[model samples]
Target: MPDRAPQPVDRQLPTDEARDLIALVRDIVQREIAPRAAEEEEAGLFPREVFRLLSGSGLLALPYASEHGGGDQPYEVYLQVLEELAAARLTVGLGVSVHSLSCHALAGYGTKEQRAEHLPAMLGGGLLGAYCLSEPASGSDAASLRTKAVRDGDDWVLTGTKAWITHGPVADFLTVLARTGGEGARGITAFLVPGDAPGLSAAVPEKKMGMKGSPTAQLHFDGVRVPDSRRIGDEGQGFAIALSALDSGRLGIAACAVGVAQAALDQAVAYATDRTQFGRPIADFQGLRFMLADMATRIEAGRSLYLTAARLRDQGKPFSRQAAMAKLFCTDAAMGVTTDAVQVLGGYGYTQDFPVERYMREAKVLQIVEGTNQIQRMVIARHLAGPETR
Candidate 1:
């Protein structure tokens, strides 16, 4: 197959340094991640080796501060790296994104002492992290979570179950949100709970429709004790912290969606050219070619949306609405593009032998996780309506 067409350049594209990082990440994804993605997915195993490689490559800390062993790259550059990784293997991409979100609480809200003690391990190591915000009854309405944390001298005793926790079983640490004050979002507090803490346990891994290599499990916090020092920010700041982290995390997911869409589009284009029909390639037909054109267009638009949001984030501007829009649009486009990719491949596309089918399966979860697309719409709508209306 010929090299895929160069990505369209936007007027607001990144600087030379950002472009170089994007290129490096793309090279790493194609060389190191693409080959192992299928096998790892088939085996239902998380790609620990890939995480180690990324840590060594300094990719894990792309969006963090350079003072703490991080690359401190702008979100505009960091998100493209995530996109490239997701194009090769979504499990790794999503895992890295979640880990980054887990670190956000510390980076944004932790005390100076907390940052000094924990940021190094988080930014420098191959260890993974999990964000504990969702519960069985409090996914979209996360502020209503019933997880409780009671003060106990110099520590807090946590007792609750966090459902749908990505990397639940294997994470080195979990940034847990629990009720500490009154009720609703204000009562919540964020705690950095060690994975191996007593009374903390993970349920059997969930069998999912996609992103199978990334484990999803329920985290049981049965009287888990955490030092008061592990609390992130003020006692009533958990909800705000979680929301802030998600604003950035949504961009990561959006970028991943764009990458997946691009991958599907590339596969469809290649397959359309090779599979002959009516004594000529199907790609020669205008009708099918139109579909390919649409797919390519959507992918580019999605890329543009996420990049714009990333730029807004880098500029320290209001990015919540844009992030939501990007997440909603890109994931929906990914689903469309991947489904079309399968149609272009016909019977072969539906089978395990093809990566497009896997891409299609993986696309569905992006719509659900990191706040469902429905929630994303609500966010965008609320933002558009202004704070007074909200």
Candidate 2:
């Protein structure tokens, strides 16, 4: 079956500008993205031109400062835009989130000169970006990353490997975290490195179950030289900056998760209402009706959870715990809702004919990325009952 345009979500947006922004996003997605999403994803083709289009449209920099080519929108508005994009295609939505995450360290902690020199090109010049924190040996324990950066007069020579980086091979820039001191979080530092810098090379992209359109690869930095001016924050502050980025990144993932669930729910509802059995529409059956109702409820709850966390962030309040909860709940909800969507489609859901099976596969990664759902639980626990004692 051909892909249907998703139903527009009814949102209580904060302002007319926010509403208009979402309308624009929907128009772009319908016209430019959704039609090609399945075919490109099936062929594992990353849509670089779509990203360039988003950059030119100013959709790629919605949550940052206006002085530096960003839209200066609040987190709440930015996230809704993500939902709309994700509802159309996971690669595009999550790609936006990762690019925003890659920009976070420099945008938040860099000096005025650094911001002015780099932020505009990064935010709006159509330059793609990647975040480098995970190593082959360190996925969740990012503080223990062993990528080393040695100072050499006015430059730093970096040598290590970054694993599972989104946009790894195609990025125009990288936000890298490398150890500059002793072990653990305090020893690390953040740097903004040019993606094509000498000695920076990406391994082949990973073969994945879903979101194949987004390349995930391991980057090798073999004596990649970066100037001292490229350092994002003080030495030993990289891990802190990474954690801060992940706090917001988690919310981005949460919004994307809700988008995926909403998309799946939309597909399920359409299928259920039109698909017939016993000479009657499946919509007449209570069993399927209850399933559809539950799916919609979960999507609503997940949307509400993420938005509540976003509101806390926009107020400049401490929202780490809320972010964690939103990430955990929203992703799990995506996984469940997508699975139920497949069930609603019966045998067709198991095939590649419908998108729900792909939705199911795509939903799985959301629980595992940003931070695993288990890690999100630990984060929430530390906020609630305090950290666990060794």
Candidate 3:
């Protein structure tokens, strides 16, 4: 087999470093993560060891500053790494993205002392993180959230329930948004709450349709107390921080979407060639071949969109709209590609015996989370409509 002939390297996309990073990630994911994904997902078990592996490999801290033991890679490179990870295991990839979102507040808004205290543990420790912004009543309209953080002399006491928090049950820390003033977005403030804080508790994990291994739950904060030093930014800045973090987070989700679509396409292509129908490989059939071609085209398009958004971020340009577009387009593509992949596989695709079915289930969440495709469309439309219309 001559070592199975080295896989042709993907062409460098604007930078050799980015290409190298993607290849490294792909190698790690194919060798380690993909092997255990089905078992973990079947048992609804969290991939603690996998997170340790990622941290050890320096993948967990790719986009953070180098001073904090990070890889100091650009977002453009970091996102492609995420794509490779997701193609292997959605649970782990999503966990990484959510942890990165949780760290964004500290990286973007924390004072020097705060970053020194938190960044190393978050970036280097094999610990996961969760973002607590969405409440049961305030999913899209986060500004109207009722969670409260009241000043108590030298400390702040938080009380609220955060809904649909990824990594909620096992996270080491949470970046929480709560109302510290009057109503509306301006009244909100961000807090860095340790998972073991005295009054913080996580509800039983949700029985979700997909990404079951990633542990989603409701986080209950009942007078969780922390020193004033835990606040990420000045009063009334939480909403802004959350929104800014989301712009970046959306790109992460978009990358995950592309990865999921790619995984489906890969599985479908392999199955098509190996499984024969009418005495010939189904891959040789024009109709099935066209479907595979379409899947590949969409996956590449999704990849390009996210990479473009990432490049804009690297250049310090406004990219919220681009991020939203990528999120919307790629996630929808994932859903479509995965669904068609099942069609290509026919009966086997509907069963756990194949990966495409699982890919389809996993693809649905990408469309809903990170501000649903509906919200992404709204954000993109608002951007296109200009400031006056917005």
Candidate 4:
């Protein structure tokens, strides 16, 4: 069968507006996004126009201050929206999360004047963004990134390559973290650079295992001069800014993971009930039923965990550890659930004709992105046992 409408997600929105917003999203997914997802992904096409439509529809900036053209929704509402979108297409869902990550440095750390001047355009002005922190030599050890920013007369000159940047080839802006001081984390600072800046260019995108519709590439920043006014936080503050953004970004990934898992489970259940073996529907078999149960359980648990972390964030509490745990558990659950989904469908699941195989492929990246599962574990351990010995 072709892709079905997005599986209806039972939601507990706090307000009527949130409910309406979700309804709008579901309508968009069914009408505009879902039908083209599989085909476009197969073609490795990025639907840049979809993002513009989302921006025009006020769906692009839901969790920021309303004063800055944001919807001012809480993270609780925002994450649920992500989960819904991700269920339809991982590229669109994860792309929004990354764009939000790209907006983080400015939203959280930029000066009041900066926020006023830029946040409006960024949040809903139909612009897309990318975040730059990792390099060829520094993925987990972000502090070891060699991207350097030099202080010139009232301007900062940036020169270095950032690898694995989402939306790199087509971003409208970038929130970049670069070294300015010594050798470690404290030496870093954040800057917001327009995509049209001189000497900034993106390499060809990577050939990925999945989410091919989302470009992942290396960005070259060679003597890109950004006025001091574009500097987000103080010099020596970029690492902290980046970490803080990741704390929230991880939760975004967690929600997306749950979304993909839910989509896979939906497909599996649909297939199992219709396909028969031993003179009965496969879903009637105890083994198949048990697998479906486990998949649903994990999806539920992942949703609850991510929402709990989002609630903590919305309440102004420190939620870094919970975010890490959500990222770890939800992504692992997605991997396992999707893999099992393929198995439940037997030979049919292994084929490209079905989306379960695609789900399985997409789930692998969630475990690695935002932070690898191992990195997430280390983060949680630090909250429990403190930093490791050098």
lDDT of 3: 0.88
Instruction: Report the number of backbone clashes for model 3.
Output: 0
Error of 1 at 35 (Å): 0.9
Q: Write the per-residue lDDT of candidate 2 for residues 54-88, one digit (tens) a residue.
A: 99999989999999999999999999999999999
**Estimated TM-score for each candidate:** 0.95, 0.99, 0.95, 0.99
Q: Looking at model 2, which ten-residue stretch has the lowest summed lDDT?
A: 1-10
lDDT of 4 at 197: 97
User: What lDDT score is found at residue 296 in candidate 2?
Assistant: 91
Model 3: lowest-lDDT 10 consecutive positions: 1-10
| lDDT against the true structure, each candidate | 0.88, 0.95, 0.88, 0.95
Off by over 4 Å in 2: none
Candidate 4 residue 198 Cα shift, in angstroms, is: 0.9
Candidate 4 residue runs with Cα over 4 Å from true position: none
Scored against the true structure, residue 93 in model 1 reaches a CA lDDT of 83
Which one wins by TM-score: 3 or 4? Answer: 4
Task: Provide C-alpha RMSD values for all models, in order.
Answer: 2.5, 0.6, 2.8, 0.8
